[model samples]
Target: MKGRLFLIPVTLGSPDYRYVIPEKVLEIIISLRKFIVEDIRSARRFLRMIDPRFPIDESEFMILNKHTDYKDLDGMMSFLKEGSDTGLMSEAGIPGVADPGSDLVLQAHENGFRVIPLIGPSSIYLALMSSGLNGQNFAFNGYLPIKRADRIREIKNLQTMARRGQSQIFMETPYRNMKLLEDIAATLDNNIYLCIAANITHPDEYITTRTVSDWLKKGFPDIDKKPAIFIIGIKS
Candidate 1:
């Protein structure tokens, strides 16, 4: 019988897993000696953070990321077929949902492996629930285009959907967060509300929702190099 695939979740940035990670999830992570991970170093660090004495040497890890070849997935799946329960983890947050582990989960399903998803912090949902935006109807647009012009165009398109009562959520690279905020303030109407949730789950976490005009007057936060979520919607 094939072993199960556990979809694991890790903390956003806080080293203290007690804050965001549940006890059950931590135990599951500790039990799994073999893992299919996005970043081996980070995965190992997380394991050790949860339990100082975690055996780093005995564990086996298979890399799964943009650079990972598709052919390597079948090899990674071997652990399950051989009755070794495996855990799939991301650098932060839970597996899947804008994560590379989605591919591995899909493969597991197709091969008839039992996949169990553990509960934990998700930057996307965490931001949305805090933002007083339209929760019943919303979309996660992942990352916006890098080019200024193209990103502005996409922002406008998202606003169109937002106008119909659907909220638009997107992100930008940490270094370019300020630039994205600028475009959002410049292109969006004053009444359009923007939610900026930065450094989520960290001690310095900041989450706020304000009108474009109000945000312009107050000046954007110093979040240039911080991971963040940008949500656009209209209160009315």
Candidate 2:
């Protein structure tokens, strides 16, 4: 019995070649046996949208989310121990990046399961490419602190790195994008360049680069309720 795992990233709901899963990758999904998804419901919806004929049964799906309890983890581990080939899929984007699938991957690896990641859309790298910032060196700070003071302190430290020509990237829940933008405007220097890449690969996608001051004056764009990524760069 051989234990195997596949990391599948669901970029947007569609399978566009540019920034979402490529055509070749779509074939991989059709052949997978077991699916370990962040949100089993959402994963099912996405799969239906991609291809209505996709053979994914609800029973074969396993939920591995952040809020998963110990019992769930133990059950999943037991399933993996039976030499099952599993597929890890996030609600959106690649598994193990900003998703809870990272822990599952680590656990699988520790248990001697073979882990393979298929290339797909990553908003972090896409934001970096379009940010017009220092691409040679960059760090994805993941999500920022929720508390005002802590977030400010974290941004200040990130500001220091940006000033030295390091690109700093981070994201927030879709609904909190405006709040995150406001914080950046208030705390970051006027001259620092900021890039807001929203809804990447989506129908109404937007990517813009401007100074913090200019962004403040113009007010944050009407991003509505869409997934977005933010990148900040301080002139060296």
Candidate 3:
């Protein structure tokens, strides 16, 4: 029998895995000795966090990132074909969503392999759920451009979409979070609602939704080096 491909979900940043990852998922992760991972060190650290005695040295890890060649994917499935269940893990959150594991999952489906996705914390969904915005009609716009003019234009485009009854969800590199926030406050209308959810699932987590003008009055919070989700809603 061909082994299944388990799509594992790791904690966002919480030290206690149980708080974000399920017990069943932990057990599944422990049982799998072969994995296709985004970052080997991070993946090993996550396994050890789940179980201190996890045989890190004995486990096999295959790297799957933007740099990985598509030709390597076929070889990645060889272990599964030999009846060794393989795991797909991300640096954080679930694999295949805003992560590099999507290609592997699509290849698994094409090869008729069973794919199992485990539940865990997702900053995007968590932000959307917490933000009193239009959840029924929302879009996840992964990240905005880095260029000042381009980024501002994209933010305006998203604002237009939000006005049409859709919520816009986006993110930024931790170091550039404040820059993105500044562009948002500068470009967006005062009445358009914006939500900033930072350090989700971790201590010092902050989530708030306010109009652009209100946010300007309060000034940007110190989320410079924290993982965060930015959401824009048509109506508060």
Q: Over the stretch 1-236, how does candidate 3's per-residue lDDT look in tens digits?
A: 89999999999988888999878888988999999999999999999989999999998999999899988999998878999999999989989999879999999999999999988889899999999999999999898898999999999999999999999999999999988987888899999999999999988999999988889898878999999999998673
Model 2: how far is 27 from its true place, Å?
1.4
* lDDT by residue for model 1 (154-218), tens: 99999999999999999988999988988888899998999999999898999999999999999
Cα-lDDT of candidate 3: 0.92
Candidate 1 regions exceeding 4 Å error are none
Candidate 2 residue 21 Cα shift, in angstroms, is 1.4
Model 1 residue 89 distance off true place after TM-score fit, in angstroms = 0.9
Whole-model lDDT, candidate 1?
0.92
Clashes of each: 0, 0, 0
C-alpha lDDT score of every prediction, in listed order = 0.92, 0.81, 0.92
Task: Give model 3 RMSD, 1 decimal.
Answer: 1.0
What pairs collide in candidate 2?
none
TM-score of 2: 0.90
